[model samples]
Target: MTTLEQLLDLPRFSDLEILSAHKNLERKVESVEITETPDVANFIPKNAIVLTTAMIYKDDQSKMKHLLDTLVSKDVAALGIKVGRFIDDIDQDVVDYASKVDVPIVKVPSSQPLGRLLYQMLSYIWDAKTEQLTYALDIQKRFSGLLMHDVNLSRFIAELGKIINAPVILLSPWHKVISNSQYFSRSDHPASFYIEQIDDHHYDKINEGNSSFIVKDLKGENVQVLGYPVNVDTYFPFHLIILKPEQIPYPVSEFAIEQAILVLTFILFKNYKVDEFFDIMKSDFLSQLIKAKTDQTHDHRNWVDLGSRYGLVHSKYYRLALAYCVPNKDNKTKLIYRQEEAAIAKKWLEAQLPLRIKNVIIFKVKNTNEIALLFQSQEPDANKVLQTLADELKEALSIQLCFAFGNPYEAITNISSSFIEAKSALDEATRLFNPNVVNYYHPKGLVGLFENTNEESIHYYCEKILKDLAYPNDQSQKELRNTLKHYLDYNCEITKTATALYLHRNTIKYRIKQCEKLLGLSVKDPENSLNLRLALELSESGNESSEQAEPGA
Candidate 1:
C-alpha cells in the first residue's frame, strides 16, 4: 500500500506542503478523489486523499470547519487544497482544526490541474501495489530456496531477519529463546527486553495462530512485533517473533514469514523424530542397566553394550540421582500430570546441568514426574552438585523437586546397585526428612542397616528396649518419650534439652530419671542413647508400614 509519506517523495508532488497533522503523514492513501460539492465528504471513501479548491467554503470560515469535521469523521486520509485559486490562504483557525482532528492537510500548487493530480496519485498507488506483489514473490522464492539446503533453524531465522531488515527470535513452547538473529546483539537493548515485554495474552493469541500485533518495549515506546506459531508434529509448539524497527516504513512480508515457519516446522519435526528414536534407545538402556545384577552367571552383555554407547565407561566412578516432583500439600489434587510442565522442566534440567556441572547424563525416567541423572566423578561432590541442580530447577521451573543420590560405584556394571540404593534413599529421605530434601545413601545409618531386617524382629527389639515408651499408653508416657528423644538429639546436654523441650532444667532431669527407671538403664549413657534412637526409628518405620498397608491408604 502507498502511504501519504511515500507519495510526498514523488517528483510530481514535490511542491505539496503539509499544513497540519504532520505526525499523521504515514496515513495510507488507497485512491485519490476530487471533492465537487460541499457534501462530497458523504461520498468520499475511507483512506481516500481528497482534492479540492475550497470553492464551496472560501467565503465562510464556518463552512470550512464543517467540511473539515465531516471529512475527519469519514476517516479520509488527507486533504489537498489549491490555496491560491479558492482563497488567499487557508485560515489559521481551519488549519488548527484539521491538526486537532488528526487530518493531514496539504497545500496543493494552485497552477496544478486537479484532474492530472488525480491521475498521478492513482498511477503511483497502482505502481506501489505492483511492487508489493513482486516483493512478496521474491520473498517466497528466497525463503523457499533456503529449504532446499539442509540449513538449521538458526540459519532460517538469520535469513528472515536479513530479508525484513529486522530482528528475529524463535522461542520454545515455554517461552525460552531457542535461536535469535544477529540483529538482536547489535541493538541498544537485548532481545530479552522485547521478549519480556510481550504479554501472556499475546502468546496465547499466537498459540491459536493467525495473529499479529504491536506491543510496547521496555521503555513503554510502541514497537511493532509479529508472532507466528510453529507447531511441529502436533506435539511441540514454538513462537516465531519478528521485531519491526520504527525506521522501516514497509510492513514485513507475510509470505516470507510463512515460508520461514514452514521450513522451521519441518526441521523441528525431523529433529523430534530422530530424538524420539534416540530417547527410546536410551530408555531401554536405562531399564536394563538398572536391573542388571552382579552375579557372574547372569548375562550382562546388554547393559555393557548400552553403557558403552552412552559414554558410560566401566572404569569411571559413577553416582546416580533421581529427581521427581513434589506436589503442593494445599493443592495435591492439582498435580503436575500434564506433559507440558514436565517437558519444560526436563528440558531446562538437561540444558542447565552441563553448564553448572560437567560429566553428567540426564534422561527421563519414563515417568512424567521423574528424571534420572548419572554423574561420573571420583570426588565426593555429587551430592552438592545435585543440591545445586535441585535449587536451580526449583527456581527456574517454579516446582519443588527432591533429589536422592546413591553411593558412588567404581564400575559401570555396578550401576544397578547404585540405582537400587537411590530408590531406597528416596523412600527413606521422604520419611526421615521433608519430602523436598536432597539426600544421599548412608549404608551405616540406622535406617540403612536394618532396612532389610525382619519386621517382627525389629518390633520385638523396639518394644524390649523402651517398654511402655514404644506404645505410649498415657499422655505422661508420651511426654517422657518426646523429652527423651529431644534430650538424645541434643547430645544429652541438660541445658540444651531443657531449651529444646521448653521446660525447666529440673523438669528435664526428672523426665530423664523417670525414663531411666522405666528402662532400667541410664538414659544419658552413650550405648543406651544409641539404642533408644534406633528403637525410635524402628517404631516410626513400623507405624508407617502399617499405615501404608491399611485399606485405601
Candidate 2:
C-alpha cells in the first residue's frame, strides 16, 4: 500500500479531517507547536499529522514564536490546535497566523474532548486508506486478467495507457514503434513522428532495474515522459514502455506496469518462435529443392559411389563458404536473432542465386568477419553465383562482402579438395594487391597447380622430383625440385615463387634450367613440363625397388 494510504489507515488518525486548504493555511498550521521543548521537534516524522493543545505555547509572545519555529522546522503535516483548554477562546493571532502559513488548524472546543476529535480524525484516515487500496487492487486484478487471457500486446498496452490515464508507446530495441494505446492515436499524434523523436541514447539507458522520467519536446509540444525497461527472458534485449503527460501521478505502487509489459513480451516472443518454426520448415524445403535439382543431372548411383568412396554417406554435407562484406556496424553490432537471421539469409541466397546451390549458410565469423553461402549447387558459373550472392547479401543485409567460392562438385569425394582450394582462394583474395573476385580453381598465380589434372599424375610428379633430388652426386636436383614445386604452387609468379623458397630470381632461373637439362624436356612448355614432372614423381615411388629386390631373391 502507498504511504498516504498507510497513514490514513492508522487508528490514531481516525478523526482526522483532511482540510482542503490553500498553501498559506498549510504553512500556518505547520508553524503551530504540539511539543513543550523544541528538541521534541526532531521526534516528529515528516508525514505525521500532529494534534495538540496550545498549553505548550502558554500565550507568551516570545514562547509562541519559539514553538512555531520548532514546528515549522519539523515539517508537521497538519496541526490541530485545541482552542478552549487554556485560552477559553481561539486566539485571533493564532488563527490569522495559521491562515497565513496555510496550515489547517481545527478549533477544538473544550466541550469536545480530545479523544472524540482523535477518533473522528482516525476514522476519516481509515476511509481514505480503504479507497486507495481498492483502486490499487482493481488495477492489479485488471493486469492479472489481461495476462491470464493472453491479451494481444497492442491491446494490453492500450488498456494500460487508459489505466494510467496517459498516452503510452512501445518501442523495439531498434527504437521502432511497435504499438500504442488508443489515447495517443486519438490525439492527432503521428506514431512515426514520436518514434523518430525518441532519443536512441536514452532508450539504450533502460534496463530491468532502472526507470526514469524526463521532459521531451515532441512535434513542437513538451511532453512529460516516464520510460521503463521491460525485461522478458526471450529473444528481444528489451521492450520499452513510454508514458507521456508526466503530470499523471504514476503512483508508487510496487505493482509496476513493467510486469504487464513483460507478460506481453513473452507472448510476442512465443509468437516469434512459432514464426521461426515455419522458417526452419521452409529452409528444409529449400534444401530438398536443391537436392532434387542436382538429382536431375547426376545419376543416384554415382552419388552412392561417391559417397562410399569418400566415407560420407552419413556425413551431412553442410555446404559452406566464407565471404568478406562491407561492415554494417549498426545491424552487425546489435546482432541478436543469429540463428533465425542466418536461416532467413540462407533462404534469400537460394531465392536470388542459382538454384543448383543448396543448403546455403550465412553466419557471423567474427565482429567484422562473414561466413556465407554454404550449399549444394552444381552451376558451371558457381563462382559468378558467389559474387552475385555477395552483392545480394550486401543489398539485403546492408553489408558488402568478399566471397571465397568452394568448388561445386557433384560428389562428396571431392569436398576436402574443394574446401582446401576454397580456403586458399579466400586467403589469396584477402592478400591480393588488386580488387577482383578470386576462385579456388582460378587463383591468379596458382591456377596451373590446381588445374583439372589427374590426381595420381600430380602425386607421381611430386614423387619423381623428390626421388631425383636423392640421387648420388646430384647437387642441382634438390634446387630444381624446389623451384618446380614453388613454380607450380605459385602458378609461375617468379617474384612469389622465388620469395617463397628464399632464393634469388637468378637462382630460380638456374634451377629451372637444371630441371630442363636433367629431364630433357622444355621447362616452359605446359604439356612437356607436366609430363616431365609426372615422370619425376613416379620415379621417386618405391614400386620399382620391390621388383628389383624380388628378382635378386
Candidate 3:
C-alpha cells in the first residue's frame, strides 16, 4: 500500500534530487530492480522503481528519448539515474520528455547506493506486509473474544469507533440504520437526518471497487465522508458507515475502514453461522408447537424448556406479532440479498427489542418475508406497549413494516391459535394493502371474513349478492358499492352516512334506493342488510385481488 513517494522517503534516499515530474512521485512502487542495459524497459515489471547508471543509453540520446516512451508503456514507477558519471546531465530534452510522460526522473546522489536502496525498499515492503498481517490477527482476537463472552453489540461497535476516533454507523441491506451508533448517543434526532444526505449510489460506487471512497466538501472545507461496504463474507446485507476524520490524512483513514471491515466480517460471519444453527432448531420447535405435533412422551417438557431458555416466558397474556416486509423494485432482482436483509433485520430486532421487552422469542418464519416474535406481558395495558414497540421499530429504521398481532393467548399450549390469527391478519393486510399497515392484532369486518377465502369464491358470492352492483360501469365512480358499505357502516343513518361520504343526504338516499332496486333488497330489513354488508366485503376483497393481478403490477 506504500506509494513510490513514500518508499523513496526511506531516510537513506533523503539526499536524492527529485528533478522533474514531481507530481508523478505519488505512483506506488511494488518492488525495486536494477538495470544497466540499453533495453532496460524489458528488464523490469510494472510498479518497480528502477536504479541504473547512464550506461543504460549506450551513448545514444535518440534511444534515450525512445526509452522514456518505452518505460511509460511498461508502467515503470519511476527512474533514478546515477548522475555526473557517464551522462553529464539528463539533457533538457530528456527531462521534458520524462515530464510529458508522467515519469518521475530522479538523480541519484551517487552510484554507490545500490546496496542501501535495495535493502531499504525490501525492508519497507516487509514492514508493510508485517503490519497488515498483525492488524488482521489483532482485529480477530479482540472481536472474537467479545463474541465468546457474549458482549453487547453496541459495545462491540463502540470499541471499533474508538480505535479510529470516528463515528461509525451500520446500515441494513435496505439502507436502514440498524445500530443507531454512538453517533447519536447524545442526540435525540434519527439517523435519517444525516443518512439522507448520502445517497445509496455511493454504496454502489464503493462496492464496485471493493474499497472505500472519500467525498470532499465542494465548498473547500476540510470535511470528508468515507464510505465502506461491509459484506457478511460476500453476502451484501449490510454496510459500515464511517465519518472520515477531517484532520487525519488518508490511507490511514482508508486503512482503518479496511481493517474494521475485516474484523466485522470475521465477527458477523461466525455469528451468522452460529445464529443459523440455533435459528433452524428454534424455528423447527416453534413450527411443531404451532402445528400441535409436540412430543407426547415427555409431556412437551423439551419444547417448554427450550422456549424458556430462549426467554419465551408466559405471563397474564402472550401475544404473537408477525413482521411483513414491503418489497421494493430492487428486492425482486436480488432474491438472496433480500433474504439476508430479512435475516439481518431479524437479528437487529432481536438484539434491541430484548432491551425493552424482557421475555421475547424472535425468529424468522422459514424462507418467508415474515419475522415472528412472541412475548409475555403482565401489564393491564399490554396491547399499548406492543403497539408502541411496533411503531418505534418502523420509525427508527424508517422501514414500512406491516405488523399483525394475535389476540392474547392465556395458555402457552394454545399459542398456536395466536400464530394462526397473526398470519391471517398479515395476509389480509397484504391483500387490502390499506392503511399500508395493520397496527392491531385482530382483523375485522370484510378483511377478516375474506382472510382465507378463495379468489373465485369471493368473486362469485359478490356477483350473486350484489347483482350488477359490483360491476360499476363508470371506471372512476365506485359510488354505489362505497355508498352502500358506508350506509351500513353508519347503521343506515342517512345523515351520518352522507356526512361521512362528503355528499348531500339526498344524494346518499338516491344511491341507496338505486342499490335496493338493483339488488332487489331493502336496507331497512335486518336480514337484507346483513347480506348487503357481506356482499360489500367480498366485493372489496375481489377488487383488491384484481389490482394485484394486473399485468404490470
Question: Which candidate number has the best TM-score?
Answer: 1
Tens digit of per-residue lDDT, candidate 1, span 301-414: 755455667666545678888776665564456543435445556666777767766767777776545678888866466557667766766654456677888888877767
Candidate with best lDDT: 1
Scored by lDDT, model 1 comes in at 0.75
**Local distance difference test, per candidate?**
0.75, 0.53, 0.69
How far in Å is the alpha carbon of 482 misplaced in model 3? Answer: 20
- How much is the lDDT of residue 532 in candidate 1? 96
Ranking by lDDT: 1, 3, 2
What are the per-residue Cα lDDT tens digits for candidate 3 across 1-553? 6677777677766777767755556676777888777677886788777877767563765567777788887778888888767777777777888888888887886655766777777788778866756765676677768767876556778877766667777776556676745756765555555566566567677566544444434344443566667777455546777665543333343455566677676666777788889888778877777766354554556555667766766466777878776666656577776676567567667766677666777877875868988877744544455556556555544445567878777777667888888887777677663444545555465556665768788788778888777756664336677777788989999998777766787888888898788778788799888877787766764453222111110
Task: Score candidate 2 by lDDT.
Answer: 0.53
Residue-level lDDT for 538 in candidate 3: 66
Residue 329, candidate 2: alpha-carbon lDDT:
39
Report the lDDT tens digits of candidate 2 across residue range 150-201: 7777877788777777777776543456788787666665666655555645
Per-residue lDDT of 201 in model 2 = 59
Q: What TM-score would every model get versus the actual structure?
A: 0.57, 0.45, 0.55
